[model samples]
Target: MPERGARDLSPGTQARFDRFSPTGPKTSLLTVPGAVGAEVAGFTPVGDVMGCVVHQVGYTETSTWSADRIGQLADILRAGYQTALDRLVEEATAIGAHGVLGIDFTITSPDGLVQEFVALGTAVRATAGPRPRRPFTTGLPGQDVAKLMLAGWVPVRVAVGISGRAFTDRWGRPMVNEWVGNIEVPMATELATAVRTAARAEFTREIGDCGADGGIVSDLKFDLWPVHDVAVAAMATVIGTAITRFREGPVAPTSTLKILPLTRI
Candidate 1:
């Protein structure tokens, strides 16, 4: 077995041995605060859990588009995210954890050739009994999960939708030269709509694969920047925590209405 500790992949005999060990990193079973830490209703935290993946970005043409994939940036992003998510689940399961709460995801490029993605959270167990078919993953805090549980919802997994897109200008189109008069540049509008639709569909498909009803989608994030002065490329990201209905249970007093409304609409 490997000794669990801070894994820096450092240069030393002990580090080398720990890397090969079957066990996960040994983190102090202490309390975590903020979004990554929570005080839920029905679950207890065991320890801090983490899963890290360093992937070498596969080859992609910088110029032309490939109908199979590179043409669709969302596909490439999905592949990377899926692999990282799988690793995170594996670590939690290894420690016999029921689920992970308030999972925080981070990504960074090490050298422009490889990218590193990390998912970290607190591993917890149900206070009642064993977990469902498998441990669940959620981006929500522990308190939220507890409230959700009371409302008959269980988080299935953390889900995301991402898109990388660019559009080419069709010079001949009269709309392109809106300066001539007053006209709408339908090209940008159409391309933007198409790209966003595609990304959303891909995200829904992923959540479905987790064998759940649906997920709670947070605000969609967008990073739209210009690619030169001619074309535009945008990255749209949506982060959410997938959830499904558990048996109906009692809600907390806070879950109920506090004050009665004076009038009804």
Candidate 2:
């Protein structure tokens, strides 16, 4: 077995675990309704946890890049995001959390080559039932988690996938117009479609890696722009939570109402 503190946690984070206590005061990032929802689902909030990583990306320019080169850039960025999530899981383990809920990611790019990735969530413990060997994670809110559990599905992990593609004009090809007539940019459209397809494939692979049945996509973002005078580049990212069924077949609905209001009027 690997040593407990041998993970890549920072010095401060490691030290925090050194003085950890199970009975200490706890904290949570959930809203009041979220807290109640979690309680109803038989999960008790342990604490609010966070992980962060700042990395310097290697790719210098998108202008001269091919699809493969853009993919390499995405690989580097994916590493940063994975590292941040790993650290977050480590923190959750320190607090004996069975899982983390309502996870959110914050990414800031100071420049073209530097980025900081942060993951934040509320750690929780199952009030009853067998605990997992490693903590599970999800981007869904506590209320959504409760709903999922009631439906016999359980959150497995946060799934993320990113893909990038670059399209460039060949030699002697006519340059695409800059805000000219209403013309379809075939190259750009193809690049965008390719990136999105690859990103979703990657997202599905993430779910496979978790041994989950499927995933719930919460966010899909695409960034497309012109690079240099002859190239168009696109980057796509998909974020969601992988989930597995705990009980086979359809589950009975928890409420009969079609719409449940959050507040009493």
Candidate 3:
């Protein structure tokens, strides 16, 4: 047997131990953002985040159902709707949003087992300040100046997809086509919801990391594609500019700001 010492161990054993142990210097836990830091500091906010939830329910058809069973069908529909809404609300609460806006719900069920449901909307903090109004100068000619007005932000593209078992029709007929057309509406809505959620999370993370209040989302677009015959994928991108505003007491002569026009003649 080899002599045992505090600093002496088998190379393989040491390596394995090191691999299993957490590595790197321990960092300050208070530096973590969101609730992590709050927990460490033993502080809690006065109110909960405000947010909205949207729910979509897909159609379901059963041969056993008759005109007499319309009440049962309605009950089933209500249950599905509530489930989707609850899910959306849960997600928004997790992210600490103050409230949700424009909650939209859609449902489409071409087949019984493949019901599609979607809920979406904006999540915002009730305490957050209103967006500042910035006057944009339009250099249109006098002849066209009267008709020109600032247009609200618009998303350039939106796309969504889902992947899973193949969908069937209301009559329990499996769709032979690789693509199901009836699902487009609900799928798209849900895709938009997910994309927007991701985008907002990213924006919030960036704001916290950079010590900024908030940023605007513009030129947003969404894309959806099929990963498999049954699996779908969706993405949203915001390519516009983000501006950070600071309180009035800044005196930095060396700081340079750049502004670009959206259009040029």
Show the colliding residue pairs in model 2: none
Give the TM-score of each candidate: 0.71, 0.86, 0.26
Q: How do the residues 209-250 of candidate 3 rate in per-residue lDDT, one tens digit apiece?
A: 534334444344455544323333454443221223433433
Off by over 4 Å in 1: 1-40, 58-62, 65-73, 172-186, 249-265
User: Per-residue CA lDDT of candidate 1, range 1-265, in tens?
Assistant: 3233464322332332333323454442334543233444566665566666667666655544423223454555666667766666666665556888877777789687777777777766677854665678887776677678768878888888776677755453332443567665565666667667767876798789887788887557665544434555566777788888868777546666668888943
What's the CA error at residue 70 for candidate 1, in Å? 5.6
Query: Model 3, poorest ten-residue lDDT window?
Result: 135-144
Best by TM-score: 2
How accurate locally is residue 202 in candidate 1, as Cα lDDT from 0 to 100? 66
- Let me know the TM-score candidate 2 reaches against the reference structure: 0.86
